[model samples]
Target: MKITGIETFCLRYRMPYALTYPRGEYQEREAVLVKVHTDDPNIYGWGEAAMWGGPFSTTTTVLEKQLQPLIVGQDPCCPEFLWEKIYQETYYHGRKGILLSCLSGIDIALWDILGKVAGQPLWRLLGGFARPIKAYASSGYYRRDYGLDALAADVGKAKSAGYRGYKMKVGNLGAAVHSRVLHETPLRVSFQEDIARVEAARQALGPNLDLMCDATTSLDAKTAMAYADEFERIGVRWFEEPTQPENISGCAELARRTRIPIAGFETETNKFNFAALMDAGAIQVVQPDVIQVGGITEARKIAAYAQMRHLTFSSKNYSTAVSLAACINLLYALPNADFFECDADPSPWREEFLKSPLFTFDDGIVQPFDRPGLGLDIDEVALSQWVVQP
Candidate 1:
């Protein structure tokens, strides 16, 4: 069926308690979701553009002004053609960031449409490698009053919830400079406190489960190397984004020097950049957000590349439920799918986005969804309050 129109919604979920990473303090979660309408009244697909990189209006504006114009009459079934068409037209001005993220929403919607039309689930539609994909609980953002005791409690919760692993933050050391962007007035957690947090988590998790740390790109190569030494000593499974994503050599150095697997560049938008990171031996685990990296179409390319290189491929989780489902769908069909990020945060976004949970968890592993499309049946009521007019 031909595309008829597109609807955009900017959603903002205010957090009860604010959380801090290495770069910024976030008080709310924001996303731009798009609904693609087709010629038939019966068919439509949902998509989302994450708002962590830029303003929410920027993404929605691009959807309404730029992408919708070209996509209005095109067939949503041909996601591949539309993806390239949009990329080629916008590459001059929109190679990465908000532009590609907008494209990603539409691309995901197009795939959802294709899956519905074909009467197959997205994972099966893409490749259908295997059903169950491994998952790691992703949370532990720094917050006021959340000490090692609170950290241990969260770890225990994840373990009790049947998660195989849990990932926590690590930029508390003095002037934790994680990303290359260089934010002013960064927060600090001393080395002693940081180690205490990991040790607490390990104690709570016991010996069987996994524990990964995200440096939030807080440290440089030298600092991260020293920090990683301590992490390895604590039996930490992986060290994620220890330094700035753009520092290819620094990342390469960490991978070369450290025994812990270096995972990163979730902020990254393209596969070629991923190739550069891979080529440099920078990361042992490749992490790209499906929403940020041009949707499933581009994500698959990265996964394939990671597989070829014999590295772990895991989608950076922490977006809307639609993004979470999209990542799972893509990962289930990939050979090197290592850790699917099961957002362990207590946000109302994921479960409320859809009418019901799309996938099931078996002891922290995500079971494949066999329903048509991305298995996203949008719950408009649940989304209504978060909708932003501006």
Candidate 2:
């Protein structure tokens, strides 16, 4: 069926607790949801672009004023054609950042439509290699009044929730340091302090459960290598984004020096960038966010490329329920997918924004929705409540 109309919504909500990383702090979360209506009766598709720490308004503008117009009358079934059309048309003015992010939402929605038309789940439609993919609790950001004790408690709770593994944040100045001070100085934590937090989490989790840490690209290669040795001692699974995304050489060096696998590239926007990372032998695990990397179409390409290179493919998906659903579908089809990142922290939007449960976790394993398309029924009433009017 032909595309009829496209609508975009900007949702914003105050986070239950402020979270701090190496970059800064976030007190609120945001997402941009897209709905594509088709000519066929009773057939529409939904998708979301993560705006977690970015400007939702800018992404919304790109969706409405730029990308939306390009795809309104095209065939929703041909997501690849439309994806390329949007990318090539906007190549001069927009190839990355919010532009690609906007394209991502639309592309995912189109895939959802295609799945509905085919009467199949997205994963099955793609490959259907595996189901009930393993997941890890992605938590442990520095929060107000939160210390090592609090971190230990958080890990314990995730274990009790039946997660197989948990990921914690490192490289922040620590709970004692104010975010304002961090913004000004951006000081890296001492090696000793970083080790202490990981050790506390390990102790709380015990030796069996998997443990991972994300530095948010705050540590240099030298520091990351040193920390890697300590993390290995504590049985940490992997180190994520220890150095900036631009420092491909540094990441390569870090990977070479340490036995711990280096995972990153969430900030990358295209396959060419991923190829560069692979060519450099920089990252062992490639963490591509579907929305950030240009939707399912591009993500599939990246996953295939990672597989060809014999690299592990795990995605970075700690946003809204829509993004989580998209990621699960993509990962289920990928043979080499290691883990699906789940936010251990609570989010009202993830639970309350949808009429039906998008996914369920059974002892840290999540199964794909059997229903056609993305298998999500958006709660329009709940969505209206959180809509940011322009």
- Model 2 stretches with alpha carbons more than 4 Å out: 173-182, 185-189
Each candidate's clash count: 7, 0
Residues 25-112, candidate 1, lDDT per residue (tens digit)?
7788787888899998888988877667577677778899998998989989999899899998888898788887888899898999
Best by TM-score: 1
RMSD of candidates 1 onward, in order? 1.7, 2.5
Question: Model 1, stretches more than 4 Å misplaced?
Answer: 178-187
Candidate 1: deviation at residue 191, Å? 1.9
Task: State residue 269's C-alpha deviation in candidate 1, in Å.
Answer: 0.9
What does the lDDT read for residue 22 in candidate 2? 77
